[model samples]
Target: MYYSREVAHQIEKLRKGFPVISVIGPRQSGKTTFLQHYFKHYSYFNLENPQTRDLIEQDPQQFITLNPKNIIIDEVQRLPDLLSYIQVHVDKQQEMGSIVISGSQNLLISEKISQSLAGRAAYQNIFPFSLSELQMHGLALPGHLDQMLKGFYPAVYTREIEPNEFYNQYIVTYVDRDARLIKNIQNLSQFQKFMRLLAGRVGQIVNISSLANDTGVAPNTAEDWISILEASYIVYRLHPYYKNIGKRLIKSPKVYFYDTGLLCALLNVVEPQELATHFLIGGIFENFIISEFKKELSARGLPVPLYFYRDQQGREIDLIFESKTKLIPVEIKSSSTFNRTFFDAFTYWRKNIQAEISGYVIYSGLDSQKVGEDNLLAWNKLDTLIDHL
Candidate 1:
C-alpha cells in the first residue's frame, strides 16, 4: 500500500543541503522502490543494465551531461568510476538535490563516495519496513506476539507467498548474488556455510576465532568475511558499552542480522509455528526485536549505542539503552507468559548502577502489564517507546 518511510523526511532535508544523497542497503530492501516513490520526477537509470553501464563507462562526462540535474542512479556501485565525474559535476554546479544514488554494496559505493564526494553527499541506510510504517497502512497484526518470530520483510508482509519458498528463493537469489558477486568473495561455498553458522549464533557475543573454528577457516578470514557482510548490510556488529565502570565488561561485540527474515531463511525457519519450536527461537526473537529497535532509532537520526549487560558473576540483561546518563535495561522473552525471574537481572542492574534504572520485559504476549513494579510491554508497543524517546 506504499506506507511512508521515516527516511523520507531525512532525504528531503538532505536534498535541501547536499548535492548528492546515497541510499545504501542490502538487495531487495526496497531502495529502488523507495526512491521511485519519493523522487517521481527524477530521471532514473539502473547501472546494472549493460547498455547503461557501458554508456557510463565509455564516457562518464557525457553520461553526466545527458542527465544534468536531479538524476537517480540505481546500482551506482556497478560503475564506481562515475562517482568521480559526479563529484566534479556537483562541485562545479553546486546545486542541491542534483543527484541521488542507490546501491547494495556499501563497501565499494561508500569508499568511492568518500574519496570523491566526501563533504558533498549525505548517506542513509534503507532498512526493511518498520512497525510504525506498517501501522500507518493499517496492516497491524491482531496478535503481534508472533511478529518477532516471523519477522517483518516487505514481500513477506505484502504477498501471500509461502514463507518457505519465499525465504528459500531469497537466500538463493539475493543473498547469494550479493555475497559472491558484489562482495567478490572467492570461496562461495565457505561463505554460505559461514552465513548459516552466523544465523545459528545470532544475538551472541562475537567470537571470530570460534566462528573460524566452526566454519573451518582461518580466524583472519572469518573476521574479514564478517566485515564484508557488515559492509553489505547483511549483518550488524553491536559493540559493548563501557565507559568508566572498573569491572570487566564484555570487550567483544555481538552479531545480528539486519533483517530477521534473512536470518530465519538461513536457519530454514519456514513459518511462525516452526519458529516457536526451533532451538534458536529465543535468540532469534531477541535479535529481531533489538534490530528493529535500532532501525527505529536510526530512522529518527539518533545514535544507537545499543549493548547488552553481562557480568562475570552470571547476571545478564539482553538489551541495554544508555542515554542521558541513565541505563534502561530490557529483557526479551520468547514466551507468551511472564515470570518473576525476569526481573532478577533488572534488580541486579539497578542495585549496581548509580544512574536511574528502568526495566522492561518485551514478551510475545497480547496484553501489556506491570510485573512487580517493572514495565512489561508488548512487542507492538516498541514503536510507542521509540516515539516517547
Candidate 2:
C-alpha cells in the first residue's frame, strides 16, 4: 500500500525545472520505494547491484549513452563520478528531469552533488511519514504514547513489523553498515552504547565530553559519531535561538532522534502502555512533537527554522519557529490535562522580544482553544499550528 507522500508534489515541481533531481534521506525511509512508484516510467537502475555497478564502472559512457533521459538512479552516491557524466549529458541535451538520483548517505551525496551536479540538480528530503500523511491513510493513532511507540517509519506500517523488532534491527544495521560507511569506527559496540546514551538524553542539550565519558570514548569520537548520525538522518540537532536579551543564553544544541520508535527501541521501551509511567516520557513526547514539525517542513521542501530557547536564568521555550519577519514560540507538554501555567515560559519570552507574538502550548489534551493571546493546541492538531506558520 502506497500512502501518498506529501513531498511527491514538490519533487514533481522540481523535475519540471531541473535536469537532475536528488532524493536524499536515511536508509529504509522509503526513498527507493517512493521513487520507483512515482517515476515508474523512468528507466530504473540500482547501483547496489554488483552487475549494474560493474557495467557502469566498465564503461560509463556506454551507460549514459544507453539510458540518456528519463532515468532514475538508486544509490547514485555509490558511483559519485557518474553524476559528472549525467551532468554533461543533461547540459548538452538541455532536458528537464533527464536523470533522477537518490542516496541514503547524505554527506557523500551532498559533497558530490555540490561538486558535480550543482545548480542542475534540485533536492527533496524524504523523512519518515508525517502526521498529516498518516492521517490521510487513517493510520494515525489517537493517543500520543501509542503514536510515539509505533513511530512514523514506513516499514512499521508497510511491512507490519513490530516497533521494537523493527528498530532493534534498524540500530544493528545502522551501526554495522551505514555508520561504518559514513566513517570508520573501530568499536561498533562502543558506538552502540553511545547511541543509547544519546537517546536517553533526547530533547536535552548535548554534552560531547559527558557522552564520551559515559561511552568510554574520546570526546572527538563522540562529536564525530554525532555528525555521522546527523548525516545519515538518524538524529537532528536543534540549536538555540540567539538574541541579545540582556541575559546569558546556552549555546550548546539539543539532539533528538528523527523517529520516536527508534528512540523507544534504544531506551528499551517495548509497549506503548509502559510509557504511561516511564521516566523519559516527557522527553520522548517532546522529541515526537519536534520530529513531526521537522517532517512537516521537509515534506513541503521548506527550510527547518526550528530552535530551542534557554538561558542562564533557567527561562526556556521548547521550540522557536523563526520566519523572516517574526518568531513563533512553542512549548511542548506531555500532560493530558490543560493548565494555564504552561504559558509561563511564553510570558517571559514575549517580554524579552520587541515583536508582539501569539504563542502556542501543545499538550496531549484533546481540547484546543484560544487562551488570550496564546493558543492551547492538542498534540494531534499540530498541523493547524504548522499551517499558520
Candidate 3:
C-alpha cells in the first residue's frame, strides 16, 4: 500500500554526489517510511529509542564504530552532536553514499547541519503526498476542490484509517512532541491556541500585531512562534510579488499550512462535508492548492517563487508564479460552474503586467477549456500544467 514519492530519484541522485543527505519534514510526513523503503540496504538507527540515545550519548566513538558505512540515521536531530563526528568520518573515508539522515524537525536539524555539516550535506524537504504522486500510485486524482478539503496527507489519501481520528491524533502529536522537541516553549496551551488562530487566518496577509492581539501574546512572541512553525516545515509563507510596479504593495507575507488536514483539524473540520459548508472553505481551498503547487515544485528540485499580485487600484490575482522572464497569474475559485466574470482579475493581470503568457482560472470543474485565450483548468490538472511549464 506504499505509494512511491517523487523525491526518490532526487535522493538517489544526491547520494551519488554527496556523502551525507538529510531528508527533513514535519512529523509523520513519511520521512522514515520513505528512507526505509528506498535505502533498505543501509543500516538504520532510530534515535528516539532510549537505548540508541544512551549509546550515542555515552560513547560517541562507539556509535561511529557501530556504523560501518552505508548508514541511515532516523530522527538524527536527537543526536546533533554526532553530526560533526560523522562529517569528519565521511571526509576521512572519502566515501559517497555512506551517510543518510532523516529528521522530523527541520528547525533543529537544519541548525546543526549549518553549524556542523555546512557544505557537506544535501538537504531535501519531504512534504506529504502531492497530486502527481497520488496519480503515480494509480489513485483517482481527486478534483482540486476535493483535494483541498480532503488534503493530500499520505494516510488520508490511502484511507488507512478514519480521517477524524487520524487528524485528531496528528494535532495532539504535533503539539505534544514535535513542537516541544524543536523549540523550548513551555506554554503548550498558548501554542495550541496560536495554531487554531492561525487556521482562521489562512491565505490572508499576515498581520502580526493583529494575530498577537487575538492570541493575547506580544507581537514579537507571535512572530517567533510563526518562525518556529515555518522552520519546522509545518507552514509556508508566500511573499508579495512586486517589481517596482508603482503601487504600495502589501509587505506582510501570507501563511499557509503545508497540509490541509492539519489545518482543517486545527479549525475543527471533522469531515469534507463539514468543510464544504464552512465559512473558511474558500480560504482552505486556496491554501490547499497553493501548497500543493509548492510541493510539486520542490519535488522536482525547483525553487518555488509563489506570490500574489495586487495593485492600489483594487485589482488582484489569487496566485502568481514568478518565472524567469514571465509572471504567470492564476485565480482559484471554489465553484464548479465556470463563469466569464472569474477572469476579471486575470484580465487585469494581463493588461497591467503586460505579460504575454495567458493566465489561468483554476476551478472545481472536470473539463479544461480556454476562455478568450486564457486557460481554464480543473484542480487535478495542476501537475500537468507544472510539467508543461
Candidate 4:
C-alpha cells in the first residue's frame, strides 16, 4: 500500500515545464517508489543493476540506444556520467518530461546537474514522512515520547516495523555505506563514532573542534563528514535569525537530524517510553517540531527560510518562519502543562521589532487558547497551524 506524498504535486507541475525532473534525498525517503508510482507511463531503468550500469558507464552509445526517451532513471547518481548524454538527447528532442531521475545523494547529482543539464532539469528534496501524512496513514496522535522515538518514517508506520531494529539497519545500510562511497576511511569505527556524536548534538549549535576531539579524528575530517551527512539529507543546519537586535549574536548554526528515529537509534534508547526520562528529551522535542514545520513548507512549495533566534543576553526562540510581509515566531516545549513564561521571548520580540510579526507557542498540552498577543497551540493541532502559516 502506498500512502500519499505532498512532493508529488510539485513534481507533477515540474514535469510539464522541464525536460528533466530530479528528486534527490536520503536513502529510504521513498524517492524511487514515489516516482515510479507516479510515472508508470514512462519507461523504467535501474542503474543499480550491474548490466544496465555497465552499459551506461562502459558503452554510453548502447545505453542511449536502449533508453530512447521518456524514461525514469533510478539511482542515476551511481552513473552521473550518463547525464551529459541525457542532456543532449533532451535538447535535440525538446520534449517535456523526457527524463526523470532519482538519486539518494545530493552532492553528486546536484553538481552534475548544474554542470551538464543546466536549465534543462528541475529538482526538489523529499523528506522521510510528515506528521500530516502519518495522520493520513491512520496513525494515532502519538505521545510525546512515542513521537520522538518512533519518528515520521513511512516504512515504520506502513509495515508496522520495530523502529529500533529498523533504524539500526538504516545506519549500517546508508550512513556507513555512504561514507565509504564518498571517501577512503581507514577506520569504519571512527566514522561511526562521528555520526553517533553528531546525532547527540542535534538541536544544539555545532562545534567542529569539539566533535573532532571527542571522535578522535582531525577537524578537517569532521568538517568533511559533516558535509557528506548534509549532502545525503541525514542532517540539516538551521542558521540563526540575525538582525539589528541591539545585541551581538552567535552565528553558529544549529544541527538537526532529518528523522528523529535515526537520531534516537544513535542515542541507543530501545523503547519509546525511555524518551520521557531521557537526558535529551527537550532537544528531541525541539528537533521534532522544527522538522515538522520544515515538511509543511516543503510540501506547499514555499521557498521561505526557517531561522532560530538567540541573543548575547541568553534570550532564545526555537523557530522563526519568515515571509515577505510577516515573521512568525514559534516556541516548542515538551511539557504538557501550558505556561505563561513560554511567551516571554515572543513578547520581547513583538515590542522590539517594528515590523509585522506573529507569535505562537506549540506545546504538548491538550488545551489550545489565545493569550494577550500570542496563541497557544496543542501538539495535535499542528496541521491546522500549518494551513495558517
Candidate 5:
C-alpha cells in the first residue's frame, strides 16, 4: 500500500529547480517510496544489491552509459566515489530534476555531496511518518501511550508487527549491520547500554560524562557513538536559545530520539499501558511533541531551526522556533490537569526577549484555556501551531 507523505510536496517543489535531488534520512524512512512515487518516469537503481554495486564498481562510466539520462539511485553512499561520475553526468545535462539519489547516512552523503555535487544538488532529510501522515493513510491517531509505544515508523503500522519484537530485531540489525558502516564497535553490549543511557535522558539536557559513567564507557566513546547515532538518524540534540547574549543561561543541548517507539524499546517499555505511570512519561510525551514540531517546520520549507531556552535560575522553555523577525515559545507538559503555572517559562520568555513572541502550551490534557499570551493546545492539535509558525 502506498501512503502519502507531507514532505513529498517539498520534494516536488524542489525537483522543479535542482538538477540533482538527494534524499537522505534513516533507513526505512520511505525515501525510495517517495522518490519513485513522485518521479515514476525516472530510471531507478538500488545499489544495495551485491551485483549492482559490483557492476558500478567495475565500470563506473559503463554503468553510467547504460542507465537512462534521468535516474534514481538508492543507497548511493555505498559507492561514494561514484558521486563524482554522477556530478559529471549532471553537469552535462541541462534539464532540471534529471537525477534523484537517496542515502541512509547524512554524515556520508553530506560530506561527499558538498565535495562533488556542492552547487549541483539539493538535499532533503526524510524522517519517519508524522502524525498527520499516518492519519492521512486512514489510521487515526491512537491515545498518547499507544502513540509512544507504536511510534511513527511506517513499517510498524503497515506490517502490523509487534512493537517489542520489531524493535528488538531493529536494534540488533542496526547495531550489528548499519552501525559498522560508520565505525567498528569493539563491544556491542556496551553500545547497547550507551543507547539505553541516552534514551533515559530524552527531553533532558545531554550530559556526556554522566551518560558515559552510566554506560560504563569513556566519555569520548560515548561522544563518538552519539555522533554515529545522529548521523544514522537515531537521535538529535536541540540547542539552547541564547539570543540574549548577556543573559547567563544553561548552555547544554537537550537530547531526543527521532522516533519515540525506539526510545520506548530502549527503556524496556513493553506495553503502552506502562507509559501512563512510567517515570519518564513526561520526557517521552515531550519527545513526541517536540519531534512533531520539528517535522512540521522542516516539511513546511521554513528557514529557521528549533531551539530551547533556559536561564541560570532553572527556568526553561521547551521549544523555541526562531525566524528573522519572530521568536515562538512552546511549552509542553505531561500532566492531564491544566494549570496557570505551565505559562511560567513563556512568561519569562516574554520578559527577557524584546522581540515578538508567539506562545503555545502543548499539554496531555484535552482541556484548553487561553492564558494572557499563551494559547493552550491539546496534544492532538500540536501541528496547528506548528503549521502557522
Candidate 6:
C-alpha cells in the first residue's frame, strides 16, 4: 500500500552529484519507508533503538568502518557528533551517494550538516503527502473540507488511521518527546496550551506579546515555542512582501500549520460538516490552498518565492510569488460564488508595483473564468496556477 513519492527523481539527481543526501521532514512523513523502498540495496540503521545508539556512541569510527558505503541512518540527530565521523568517511571514500541521513528536527540536522558536512551533503525535504500526490492514487477525498480534515499524512491513507487518532498521538509524541529533545520546557501543559492558542491564530500575523499573555508565559517563552514549532515542521511563517512598496507594511509574519488536518485537530473540528459553519473556515481554507502551493513548488525542487502582501492601510493580497522579473499576486477565498471585489487588492497593488506578471483569484467553485488581465481559478485547478507561476 505504498504510494510513490514525487521527489524520487529530484533525490536521485542529488545523489548522483553529492556524497551524502539528507532526507529531512516531520516524523511520520515516510522518510524511513521511502528510503527503504527507494534505496533497497542501501544498508539501514535506526538510531532510535537504545542499543544501536549506544553502539555508535561508543565507537563511531568502528561503526563507520564496518558500514562505510551505501548506508541509510534514521534519526541521525540522535548522535549529532557522529556526523563528524561520517564527514571523514565520505571525504576518505570520495563516493557519491555513499550515505543517507534522515531526521525530523530540521534545525539540529541542518545546523550539524552546515558545520560538519558542509559541501558534502545535499538536502531533500520530505513533507506529508501533497494534494497532487494523493490524486495520482485516486485517494484524494471528495470535498476540500474532508481533505483538510483527513490530512495528507502517509499513515492516514496507507495505515488507514483515523485523523483524530493519528493527530492525537502525533501531538503527544511531538510535545512530549521531540520538544524535550530540542529544548527544556519546565511546563509541558503550558506548551500544549500555547499550541492550541496558536492554532486559533492561523493565517493571521503573529503577535508574540499577545500570544504570551494568552498562554500565560513570557513573550520570550512564546517566541521560543514558535521557533521550536518551526524547527519541528509543525508550523511555518509566511512573511509579507515589502519590496518597493512606498507605504508601511506589516513586519510580523503570518503563521500557518504545515498540515491543515493537524490544524483542524488543534481547533477541534472533528467532522467535515463542521467546517461549513466554523468561524475559522476561511483561515483553514486559506491554509489549505497555500500549503498545496508549497507542496507543488517543493516537489519540483523549485524555490518557494512565495509571500503575502499587506500595507498599513489594510490593503492586502493573500499570496505573492516574487521572481526576478515578475511578481504574481494571488487572492484566496473560501466562498463558492465568484465576486468581482476579489480583485480589489490586485488592482491596488498594480499601481505601485511595476513587475506585475499577472494576478489570480482562487475560490471553492466549479467554474473558472477570466476577468480583465488576470485569471480566476477554481480551487481544484491549483496546479494551473503553479504552472502559470
Question: Each model's TM-score?
Answer: 0.92, 0.97, 0.94, 0.95, 0.95, 0.96
lDDT of 4 by residue, 1-389 (tens): 88778888888788899999988888888777788788878888888898978867887757767777778888898898889988888888888977899888888899999999999999877888887777777774567678778877777877868998899898888756776776667788888888999988878888989999999989998988888888888888888887754322446788898888888999998786787788888888889888888877887778888989877787888988887777889999988998889888876887776344668899987789989777899877787677776
| Clash pairs detected, candidate 6 | none
Q: What is the lDDT of residue 236 in candidate 1?
A: 86
lDDT tens per residue, model 3, 132-231: 7877777644545455556666777666786657877887777788778767788888998998999899988888999999999999999989988887
- lDDT of each residue in 234-256, candidate 6, tens digit only: 99889888765532243788999
Model 6 misses residue 289 by how many Å?
1.1
Question: Which residue pairs does candidate 5 place in steric collision?
Answer: none
Please tell me which model should have the higher TM-score, number 1 or number 2: 2
lDDT over C-alpha atoms for residue 333 of model 6? 96
Q: Kindly report the root-mean-square deviation of model 2 from the true structure over all alpha carbons.
A: 2.0
Predicted candidate 2 versus true structure: per-residue lDDT over 1-389, tens digit per residue: 77789999899899999989999998888898899899988999999898999999898989999999988999887888998888889889989987889999889899999988889999889998988899989999988888999898899998857889999999999999888888888899999999999999988888889999999989998989999999999998988888753321447889999999999999999887888789988999999999999999988877748988877787889999987778999999999998899998877877886449999999989999999899999999989988887
Off by over 4 Å in 3: 140-146, 157-160, 244-250
Candidate 5 at 11: error in angstroms? 0.8
List runs of model 4 lying over 4 Å from the truth. Answer: 244-250
The CA lDDT of each predicted structure is 0.80, 0.89, 0.82, 0.83, 0.83, 0.89
What is the C-alpha lDDT profile of model 1 across 1-389, one tens digit per residue?
66678878878888899999999987777788889999999999999899988978998999899889989999998889899999999999999988999998889898999999999999988888777777777765665435553456677776888655666687667556777765567777788889899888987887889999999999998988888888788788876656655422437778899877678888877667788888888888788788889888877776646888767675778887877666678899888787778778877776786435568888877678877657888877887556545
Q: lDDT score, residue 193, model 3?
A: 96
